[model samples]
Target chain A: MYEAALTLYGEAGWAGFSLDAVARRARVGKAGLYSRWGSKERLIVDALAAWIPPRPSGGGPGPLREELIRLATAIFDSYFDPVGLVYLRAQLEAMIYPDLFGQALERLQRERIRLGRAIVLRAVERGELPEGTSPALVLDSVSGILSNHVLSTPASQRRALLGRRDEYVEQTVDFVLSAVGYRAQGRDGLLSL
Target chain B: MYEAALTLYGEAGWAGFSLDAVARRARVGKAGLYSRWGSKERLIVDALAAWIPPRPSGGGPGPLREELIRLATAIFDSYFDPVGLVYLRAQLEAMIYPDLFGQALERLQRERIRLGRAIVLRAVERGELPEGTSPALVLDSVSGILSNHVLSTPASQRRALLGRRDEYVEQTVDFVLSAVGYRAQGRDGLLSL
Candidate 1:
């Protein structure tokens, strides 16, 4: 039922996707949906929960740079998935509405930031980042970069760039690591999955 | 007339603003707007154009890092101006509605990319950045970070951050320069600013 709701949301946006539509898509009765999820907001949130990629263990890396590249790829691919575009637009547009949709987006951003803090903390423990570096700031910057890429870059351009994900991550990691006083030129590029 | 249209667009969204409303706000007939801009789209485009801050002159600076911080602060403050948020949200939302928005957004992104390229290219000429760094890539990442700061951070947080804009820019410049094999540490931090 939740999957049906997300798919409908992805196709029609929040305004367009009616509860009846979700019932039809899910092949369930309206009463069942109402009984199970209580509201459209809960339905959407539950769908999102089911769709989110599981946290990957950042183990098996030769170096922190390599591990980071591997991690970033998973993150980007999941968030920017083509199926996720509508939800992305919905979430961004939610900022204006500031009701149900807005609350949904706020939750997502907080979760993302928390996850980002964990990543930064891991990097610090591994001695990949400089001491005294603010993980929140670094997360903010990195998240900003990736978000801009998805939101601003043309889809065609993004596809081409994704093909060269290794190169992009390599240069990015090099620049990031270098800026933070960890010279890992030897890592030099993406660590393949 | 253009000023009136910009204010309307800022108050209402692209969908909400209209030619009649613009004429009403300007206290001018609809014909006057049609004569000047030919269409609603063109009018809004010109309005955005009118709001853009002039790019910083490259002549005055100690190094690329110093100049970049100066330029960034100027750009940041300009975009954060009261009307700027409306323009930004409108522009971003337009990208999602490709057919309705036309090529205005594409042109805007290109213009932004071009400005970024100019800054980085000048830095290269001055030997502040590495020889082979792609100007486009660097600009993309830099712009990405800046865009994220604007979109994600709330206004109060932004005001707080702007108060310490010097420190933020110093940290950014310090990191970028160090990563790119330019100057290090004290040279790029707030004391120099």
Candidate 2:
């Protein structure tokens, strides 16, 4: 039932989302939907958390740059996944109609942010990043670069992006670490004065 | 007719977008729409280029950091604008149905990238940014950061995001510059050795 609901939402966004449609698509009586999830908003909020792609994970302790690379690689590669669009649709719509997509997405962002912050905080504890580095800005840069790069790339050239994924991820991670004053750990491109 | 097409696309996405619906919304005869556009794809391609919110402009050359802040600020503020949805809808859907949205959106991105690259190149020539700097990476960081930051920010705290808009832009611009090794003229928060 939830799968049916998300498929419908992804196909048309809020304008086409409804309880009736989900019921019809799922081949279930409308009554079941009404009793379980009274409103389309409620149904969608419940459906979205499971359908969105995985964000950067909070892996066990490791080098800060390696940890960020692992996290960013997850974010960068997720955009190419089918579930990624479901995430994108919910996020874009939530901006337009916060009342509908607000609660569900907030939980998701807050959770991912906590994970990201912990990673950065650990790095600071190990003297990798500066004392005042912001996890929001740090993670936001990686997410933004990958998201914007993919979305803005011409479809004709999309295949080329997949080819460069590893290199792109490495460069991005290194660039970010370098900017935050992390000393080079044997990488060649650290910017010098 | 174009206005109606964009409005409908923004509301329901591609699922509810069609020539018949657009004709009804515009109060125009279906035959007229069919005769003019022949397909919804054509109409959307014709319409979207105009309705998208303004992208970061290639204003005449100036300091790299100031130019970047101006451009990033435009992108950050745009997500709050009504027209921003049109841009978002087209971008997300384009990833799913590239054949439909490829050409029109490709032109928009390509042109903006060219302008952005030009901005970075001029700065390098003037000794503001390093000669080896990748303009694509430089501009992509600014654009990507702004896009992701806005999309991930919860709608409930949207007002707070707006309140911190200027400070956010400065931080992002300075962060990108400092990462790329640009010396701070007078800014205090630069990442230092």
Candidate 3:
């Protein structure tokens, strides 16, 4: 049912999206949807919460850079997923209906930030990052780059970028490391420092 | 007239956006709009081209970091403007009507990339960035960060960030400089490094 809702919303943005259409697509009666979710906005909020990838656990038992690379790769993969694309399209509704959409998106962003800060804090404890490095700033830099690429790039080009996901993650992680005043050490693939 | 079009489009989005509404808002007849642009899409493209800020011509006669800071600040300001909000709303239409919106957006992105590359080239020539630094990559990093912040952050928080635009630009510039293997050498305001 949630999948049906996502497909409908993705196909027709907020303006065209309708509860009736969702019911038709899901092959369920209107009463069924209404009983479960009560309102279209509530349904969307629940769908997005279920769809968003779980916050990544901290990189386990690896070098800080390696752990960061793993986390970045996971983030990039989840964002590039088809379901993630649907969530992004739905998020655009915030521009038109901030009260309806902002709550769900704000909650999601808070979780993402909290998870990102934890990763950075773990690195600091391991003596990898500088003592005063701002986790919020670092996470913003990394996530901002990924979100920009996903949202702005043309569809054809986006597919190609997704194909090179590993390289993209590595470069982004390297950029994040650099932003925090850490010179990544190694000559692997495109990053040579 | 373009401002009217932007306002209607921003308020109603692409699906609800209508030539008739634009004509009503601008207090012009349908024939006048048709004779000028021949189609709604053409008018939108023209309006955006006129509204988007001209590419910053890299701060002349200043340090490379200073030049980048200027360029970044300009890009940030343009994106947060009312007209820019309209463009961001229209961009979401691409997810639903790819063929209709994609053509205009692809052209705009190309021009933006070309201008960004020019800025990075100037910095490399002035010995600010490493010789092998990729201009496209660097521009993507800078523009991506700016776009992400504008599109994703909530309205109230976005206002707060805009209030500190200079500080934000400095940190972003510092991040980009670091990404390209250069350490910024100034400690004014928020940038402690």
Which model scores highest in lDDT?
A: 2
* Residue B93 lDDT in candidate 3: 61
Candidate 3 backbone collisions, by pair? none
DockQ of 3: 0.34
Listed in order, each prediction's TM-score against the native is: 0.66, 0.87, 0.77
Q: Name the weakest run of 10 consecutive residues (lDDT summed) in model 2 chain B.
A: B184-193
Q: Which has the higher lDDT value, candidate number 2 or candidate number 3?
A: 2
- On residues B1-193, what C-alpha lDDT tens digit does candidate 3 reach at each position? 8888877766656655667878999999999898988888888777766655434654474465777777777667756454555655555566456677676677666666676677677666656667877776776677667766655676447668878888888888777777677543343413224
Query: For residues A4-49, could you state the per-residue lDDT of candidate 2 as single tens digits?
Result: 8876776667777889999999999999899999998788888876
Clashes of each: 0, 1, 0
Please provide, for model 2 over B1-193, each residue's C-alpha lDDT reduced to its tens digit, 9 standing for 90 to 100. 8888877777668877889999999998999899988988889999976654575566655777778877888888777755656777887788778888888888888887888889888877766677888888888888888888888888888899899999989988888887776753333434323
Q: What's the TM-score of chain B for every model shown?
A: 0.73, 0.84, 0.76
Give the fraction of reference interface contacts each candidate recovers: 0.28, 0.76, 0.29
TM-score of chain B of 2: 0.84
Error of 1 at B47 (Å): 4.6
Rank by lDDT (best first): 2, 3, 1
- Regions of candidate 3 where Cα sits further than 4 Å from its true position: A31-39, A49-51, A54-62, A78-82, A86-96, A150-156, A182-193, B20-24, B27-62, B86-97, B149-156, B183-193
Reference-based lDDT, residue A191, model 3 = 27
